[model samples]
Target: MRFSLTCLGRKKPRLLASEILKNVEALKTPAKPLRSQEAEFIQAPDLSVNPFFQQLPPTLANFFKKYPPAPFRKYADKPVATNAEDANPFLPNKNPVTGRYAAPKYSLRRQSDLYKAAYRFGIAHLLPKLGNNKKFYEDKHLNKTPVRGSVMFKLTKGERTKDSRIQEVNEALSKADEIIAEHRGRAYRRKLERKSQQTTPWF
Candidate 1:
């Protein structure tokens, strides 16, 4: 019976071990070392001096260094005056034709005290309606209508004569001159005060 068992084992057929073992050595070979995923960062080059900026003129280069290139390009077309007189085109000057000093031609809307006084004393009579309800006892409005006419329109023949209108105009001009003189005095005083303050040592 033992011989029969041995015979049966031999007859069971040798399992296909050689076929399974064929690729075992290949599998045992270590995989190629995995490629590193960490990135290498190289330092950027220095930019203390720019070649383009070096090529520019000294003044232009200095200006560009202080201000960006965009604003310089944007305002390049605008004119810049070096002094105050050049900046103000309407500055007072002697009229060549008249041989007289002429004040700067300013618009009537400018908020100058002299101009206000001139308009109040000189041109106030042209409109009487403005004073119809306003009180004149406090020197607010015109006490009497200097010219006889509707508030908005002028009369062909008014109660006031040409002489009276001339007188009013003269009075107005004198008042405007006084106001201008007073303003100049005040400005001079202020300038002196500022100079004194600057000269005085704070510490």
Candidate 2:
């Protein structure tokens, strides 16, 4: 009697063995390396020659090239109007119907005062303390102290206008600049000390 082996109910004849061997050989062969298949890497684009920078005006483009975005400074020198009433005219006006006071409106005088104040104080931030009260404004001794908001609100508006607002703003700006400069100097000194510590030989 003769016998033949079968797989999945199909008989494989002896003549098909060569084809099966060829398939197994193909599977055994190694694939090409991944590095060989990839393209070479290229360098990043140059930002200085970018099309966007080329389109800007010369002064603005130069500014962008030289400095970072934050903490930009612009300076202006002009005579400040010392007269409080002339500078802040709106302080005098009262609402006739309700008898409540309104802050200075946008008259030419007020605008001039606003410009002067902005220049004196720097445009970024306002002075923290400001006001006019009988205790602060009227009393000669108390006027030396900082004005409180609640007391300032109760006083007649005219008293506030009499005080030299421009001078007050100038004083505030001077104080702020002094404090900023001191802090910055301290920070820079600390940085230098740290650098020295890193480089110096330990005994």
Candidate 3:
């Protein structure tokens, strides 16, 4: 009975692990240190190349790749295709590296959105029935945002009159003038010092 090559290989005796260790120990060369700390780094001789293997001149080196000779060139008479014919244009493309056919990806939500968009193009104006665009407000006021919930600033109780605004400005200017006069007055300063001294103890 003829045994298969793999069966014969399996039947063969494997070398003992102890014998391998004994043979390795017989060598005169010292065993390499187990720890990296004990091991000294030695530069490989192959890394330092010979002078003969120095970089060849550009003349000797190939500038462009040579075209590989085709063994079968019997189709030379056949007309070269100008416009390539597609086998299946609708089919999903394959990934070259993975060698797996790619699945066609589609967004259902985007499709639904597109379907929804098809119904509406723009605002449709009914010219004949379009009523007069008469604007109606409870009161005529510019600062509507403040009265509304989106309050950027507080609204005044009543509208300010031109005379009242001018009067307020004049009052403010008079107050400023009075403050300047008080600052320049030596008598006012003396009065202030006496008041402060009376309010607080000397200690």
Candidate 4:
């Protein structure tokens, strides 16, 4: 369930493979809407306060550039590293059913919203093609038990050195980008298992 990748020197421990896996798994699922009337909806966060795109690895960042997350002009600006929690795409909109709405939640433990935007963007890509048919959105994308998974990317239980954290994000993003590109926006463990076993740093 977990793997460790120490830096070349072994003196500086890089991020753990398990931690990187957690981030990648989180982005696969869309955030669930609050069904409770009291469930608060999040507001559109200022890119300054919580950036979603800028912090992403280059592959994903460029993809969003080619396909903007929103038509808003603010999206054009470079987003800085968010303290996790920025990955949720639902923040800008309130649940039509649950009137209660609020702003995005932040945590030092969560990964930014960057990778998730990719999957939802794929959902967006599928949307226009469907025209009025909203079945995918209603049944799959928004479904609580999405056939996919969550976009959480929870932080490790303990504090990690800055470099380890960065590496974790980088590896997760890289793995995620490949999944998005190859599967037409879906990832499953079985398919990943089919990949040629490769190691980083060429140990």
Return the top candidate by lDDT: 2
lDDT of each: 0.44, 0.46, 0.38, 0.45
Candidates 1 and 2 compared by TM-score, better number: 2
The predicted structure with the larger TM-score, 1 or 3, is: 3
Q: Per-residue alpha-carbon lDDT of model 4 for 135-169, expressed as tens digits?
A: 33345556545333255545565553667888999
Q: Rank the candidates by lDDT, best first.
A: 2, 4, 1, 3
TM-score versus the correct structure, for each prediction: 0.15, 0.16, 0.16, 0.16
lDDT of 3 by residue, 1-203 (tens): 88798975666678899988888878856866567533424532321143321342221112101111122111121222322232111133355567665532223342233223322322112011112221123222442335464644345634436678889889989787457657789776676668768856688
Residue 179, model 4: lDDT of 57
- The count of backbone overlaps in candidate 4 is 10
In terms of TM-score, how similar is model 3 to the real structure?
0.16
Candidate 4 ranges with C-alpha deviation above 4 Å: 1-50, 72-138, 141-203
At residue 28, candidate 4 shows an lDDT of: 87
Candidate 2 on 40-150: residue-level lDDT in tens?
A: 234434446677656654544443444322334221122123232222232334455666555533444434443344334343122111123112213447456556775
Summing lDDT over every window of 10 consecutive residues in candidate 4, give the lowest-scoring window: 125-134
lDDT by residue for model 1 (130-168), tens: 211343333555475655545656545554477788899
**Clash pairs, model 1 backbone:** none
